[model samples]
Target: MKSWSSYLKQFAIAIGVVLLIILVMDYNIRLDELNRLNEKATIVRAQATQAIQTQVALQTQIAEATSDRVTEDNARNNGEIQEGDQRVVPIPATGVPPLEISVPTPVPTRVKKWQVWMELFFGE
Candidate 1:
């Protein structure tokens, strides 16, 4: 009877140790999973914020597009003219370019030896 009881006690202790080890391992796995989820949530939050900011920027641009200044600029870009506006269409000169005026080139004056000597000494 004593030997049997001793054996049973040993088995119970071993079982308890194994259960503790399994519980600790499960806790570690759960902690890792929780951290991963938190990081993913942070990333998703940032993406959402960026999306909202982009939405706001697009709305601002839409509002600006409806303004008078933008409308006028768009019209001018499309070559649209208002009433009483005269559009001058430029005609390209064809066949030959306008005759260029010819001017005679002035001949260079001769520098004397004394003048060269004076310039070399004075640096003028």
Candidate 2:
């Protein structure tokens, strides 16, 4: 009977050691997971803060866009002349001719692929 009790005691001790090891491992895994979650929360908080700042900035821009000065500028850009306003076309100085857009003449030159490769590798 004494031997039976000793064997039982040994078995219980072994089971306790196994359970302790498992608990320690589970605790470590849980700690790692908690650290990951904390990191993710920090990232989310930063993103949320940035989003709020962006929202405020966009609201300010909207306010500015709707202001009287902005509206008048937009109207003027669209060629809308207000009351009591005279449209004056400014002419260049008498010596300077009006600027003319000259279309570039297309140079019709045919080159082979090998010539293009040679030009790319060397010089024009």
After superposing candidate 1 on the true structure, give the runs of residues whose Cα lies further than 4 Å from its correct spot: 76-124
Per-residue CA lDDT of candidate 2, range 44-116, in tens? 9999999999999999999999999999999999989999999988876888787889999999999999999
By TM-score, the best candidate is 2
TM-scores, one per candidate: 0.60, 0.64
Please give the RMSD to the true structure for each candidate, in Å. 10.7, 6.1
Error of 2 at 53 (Å): 1.1
lDDT of model number 2: 0.96
56, model 1: CA deviation in Å?
A: 1.0
Name the Cα RMSD for model 2.
6.1
